[model samples]
Target: MPDNARRPGTDSTDRVDRTDRAALRADCASCFGLCCVALTLTRSADFAINKEAGKPCRNLQEDFRCGIHTDLRTQGFPGCTVYDCFGAGQKVSRETFDGQDWRQAPQTAQQMFQVFPVMRQLHELLWYLTEALSLDAAHPLHGEIRRGLDETDRLTRLPADAFTDLDVAAHRDDVAGLLLRTSELVRATVPRRKKRDHRGADLIGARLKGADLRGADLRGAYLIAADLTGADLRLADLIGADFRDAQLSGADLTGSLFLTQAQLNAARGDAATKLPSSLSRPTHWDR
Candidate 1:
């Protein structure tokens, strides 16, 4: 069976434990063409062409798989390669819609497209909440993380219209505050060091190899194509950090705050890169 095939007793509203990583990871085999159709892209460095929302990409297959899945980067679809739906595509496809596909039931296509992005945001929060709950140093804030995780999960299970109408940004703000506290709590254990504030700094293509970035505030910083090889990123606040094409070989992110899979996938890494147990090494990383 596929990785995300429906397990017995698992339904749309079922609440799994926060530590269940399988539920939080993207299960492409279980997803319909949600990402290919629901998302809009503009022609830029990230995308080779432009596409409007609710329209299927030319490369999307009738079976709901990308035609250029193996060569997306080479085929000028690098953005697609870096995108992660955080398991929302599968949940919205299989559980929410009960395996009803947009192609078969075109009437529901509009609603499905609208709900996909909302559910994607909720699931992203679930990823962060789940990881927060796993931090031993953040035990005191486990209650907050659990509450956020429950609420986020509940949001994902809502009906399509309800999910679309949700004020996801407001919920994200609430969860962001909690995550900030969680970061502070975890980083407190690290020995006192100079606090580096690189929030929103543009370090694109800059050389940061082997730099000490411990306890740095890198929120929203653009590090695209930055050479971060062997950098010490322990206890750094990496919320919204752009790491696309950054080199992470031998870099240590053991306790980095708010690092997402999408960010990791966008960057280049190797087996020597150190990461928190909650996050997996990107498959593209060189072994």
Candidate 2:
């Protein structure tokens, strides 16, 4: 169960089910600025300069807020604006470390840094699992999805040492298997080819405007800066597709499988971008 979760075995526990899902969204207000300190950033199109892991970002304030929060994209930190930890930062700060601050508790800094990433992977899995359970086409796999969600949620509550020793990759592999099955089950309902496999394709800067990509398996495909304007992406499997800077104006993503909020945030969408009811239009999208 999550922080305020009630008894889980009751028929009337649907309220907690929604809260459990909401907990996976990034909650910066409850975090300790973990991402700014624990993740490495290199000077590139996204970041202004280089910063190593375990070092606080120069723009991180004493109150754990970004110094230039509002102007991150204009200040060459567009990467920060797209990154989401899936609420792992607050879980580590409030649950694992019991509200300890790395700046004040210098002795706890190293362990906290190590645990943050581990918790992040677990939370990301939780995000996928929660999404899987909501798919009506995946009704057959709801039992397995719930079990996976519960297990992943429990793992997020582990202590610092346990997190440091956790085999997150192995866990991710197991969850991936489940998600793949869920994707297959859901996509089968759409009238596309049995296998629209485009996994890991180098589609960067591809001019795919108004293409019919419905029910395509684009898992992990490099779609960076691809022109997908007005594409028919209904029921497409976009589990790990990189949509950074991709043009999605007038694209239809209704019933898309495994699409995440982070991916949508990275892409450029407009008022004409048709999204599933589960996902909202990116705030930066042209209205």
Candidate 3:
């Protein structure tokens, strides 16, 4: 199964306009609660109970809103807070299905559930491609990034039936290649000596407090519960890095690459945690 959904970020150095990213952020108010029903919930720290795919959560109201929206963490459903469908939920609900919700048209439920995930992957790629195009450092590959963005956007608009046969993995690989180049170009601005490569490393619970990790390649690194207090991570490539329960207090991530709001939502941080202007501080951080 695919991982939960997410979104993108931008900053002052971004070349792309912020208004163009409206379709990349989740709009729950315009959705049909697809995430609540389409995703399987395991009985873990993230969820209060197990829920099978296509089955609505017990907390789902008739209006397609979570009943415990304000108290999700207190109700043991913190996982719901970090999930971002990258605006795929509404696209699937309104565009793909013509706004016909599962409750009204039970026959469409199965197909909608299957297509939702595929649409999400396409949308996630769009998020990354959009962010890549925004970075001034990636200007050398702007043409290629734009092409990838256009292609991914086209894929997202494909007919729902076309999704079943779509080779998303291949497309993702193609996009990943472009993003890798983007990461390299952006991180190169930092001094060669300061560039730390920890790609795919197992650093769970590692003590990295106040560490100088500027321009580090931390892709797919396992940083669960790691201490990153006051760490300097400017311009680091954090794509696919697991920051769950990790400490980000006072960490400087102003120019971090591929650092999404979902990642920040999963980790612990405080008011002093510096972030890119494009990303917002998680409300839970204050609590």
The C-alpha TM-scores of every prediction are: 0.91, 0.91, 0.92
At residue 215, give the lDDT of candidate 1: 83
**What's the lDDT for all of these models?**
0.85, 0.84, 0.87
Once fitted onto the true fold, the runs of candidate 3 whose alpha carbons sit more than 4 angstroms away are 1-19
Error of 3 at 252 (Å): 0.7
lDDT of 3 by residue, 67-146 (tens): 98999999999999988888889888877887899999999899999999999998888888888988999999999988
Better of 2 and 3 by TM-score: 3
RMSD of candidate 3 to the truth, in angstroms, is: 5.5
Clashes of each: 0, 0, 0
Sort by lDDT, top down from the best? 3, 1, 2
TM-score for candidate 1:
0.91
Model 2, 33-135: lDDT tens digits are 9999999999999899899999999999999999999888889998998888987898888878888889889999999999988888887887788788888
